[model samples]
Target: MAHVTFGGKPVTLLGNEVKVGDKAPNFTVLDNALNEKTLDDFKGVRIIASVPSLDTGVCDAETRRFNEEAARLDGVSVLTVSVDLPFAQKRWCGAAGLENAITLSDHRDLSFGKAYGVVIEGLRLLARAVFVVDSNNNVTYVEYVKEVTEHPNYEAALEAAKRAK
Candidate 1:
């Protein structure tokens, strides 16, 4: 279990967080179109899994920032994972005009959140995390935000993705 904070309140996350050297576990998540997407589809690119809550302000900003930044970078794909429904995610993206990265929903299985060790047990929400996976499917960077209310170390994660290539 991992301990994280939301708005200064400590929260516990279920399952184990993946280490930098470990091969990321396979996860099934739903795309904005409600299509199933797995890690296999993103085999050869640097991937940044940004877990967020669309209902929150910090998460909203994080997604927007990464969406713009991730679009400009080549050979890197940013996937924002949330528990929000597909319709809500699609609506939010359309309203925000976010195109660089993809927003995925884990409401159906809740497996992605658990597998990623971002699921908050009692709260039924995911802890904010930024995981960077290299082309070889090795986890290169991991930041389980100590304070969910705060933003992630975007520069560090981005650098790790770039350096991994």
Candidate 2:
């Protein structure tokens, strides 16, 4: 498992830690409309970004950055997963005017968080991380941010997505 921290304090993460070259784990998350979504639903290259909550500052900025980048990345689907409720996620997207990236809620069950090894043991939130999965469902890039409050390496993740077939 990757060592991570929240607010500079060490935190334990639960689940099987994902890594580059591993097959992307399947997860069930709720879309804005409360529809269940799974890994198979999204075709082509996928950028799966996990965050604690969409309400927080770091998560907000990260999602927004991905939204902007999604516009230029052809055939790439950017999915942001958080423990925030579907309604709250929808509202945030609306207020933020985010069109390119889709927000999914893992609040019902830590399905996405646990599957992707981003679950914060005691927090009931996901640790900050990003996984770029190619069309074949192979994880091409993985980034587990050491600090939950910081943003990920956008350039590297984006480059991996571009290279994924």
Candidate 3:
């Protein structure tokens, strides 16, 4: 379990984030259309798992930023996961005109968040985290924000993902 903060208050994470040398965990999440998707479906491409909660302002900023960045990368795909329902995710994405990254809902099976070590126990939200997986399914970069209210290191993450050669 990893330790993180929500609004500067200490909060404990349930699971462990995929380490730099660890193989990415295989899990299923629902797409905006409510269709099931797995890690294997995105093989041979750089994957940036941006786990966040749509209910928070920081998460909203993170998702929007990633959505814009994801569109510029040719072989990279960003999958944003949240506990919100697919319908809500669709509505937000459409309203924001976010067309690059694919937003997946983990409301049904909290397993994805659990496996990624981003689940907040008491609250029904996910701790903010960024995981970059290489084409071989190995985690190349992992960042679990110490403060939930803070934005992630987008520059470092984007550079790492873009350097996959």
Q: Which candidate number has the best lDDT?
A: 2
RMSD (Å) per prediction: 1.5, 0.8, 1.6
Q: What is residue 115's positional error in candidate 2, in angstroms?
A: 1.0
What's the lDDT for all of these models?
0.80, 0.92, 0.79
Report the lDDT tens digits of candidate 1 across residue range 105-163: 88888877888888887877888898888887888888898887788998898888778
Off by over 4 Å in 3: none
TM-score of 1: 0.93
Judged by lDDT relative to the true structure, which candidate is superior, 1 or 3? 1
lDDT of 3 by residue, 30-77 (tens): 988788988887865555554556656877888888768866887887
Instruction: TM-score each candidate.
Output: 0.93, 0.97, 0.92
Clashes of each: 0, 0, 0
Clashing pairs in 3: none
RMSD of 2: 0.8
Q: Which ten residues in a row are the worst by lDDT in model 3? A: 43-52
Q: List the lowest-lDDT window of 10 residues for candidate 1.
A: 43-52
Q: Score candidate 1 by lDDT.
A: 0.80
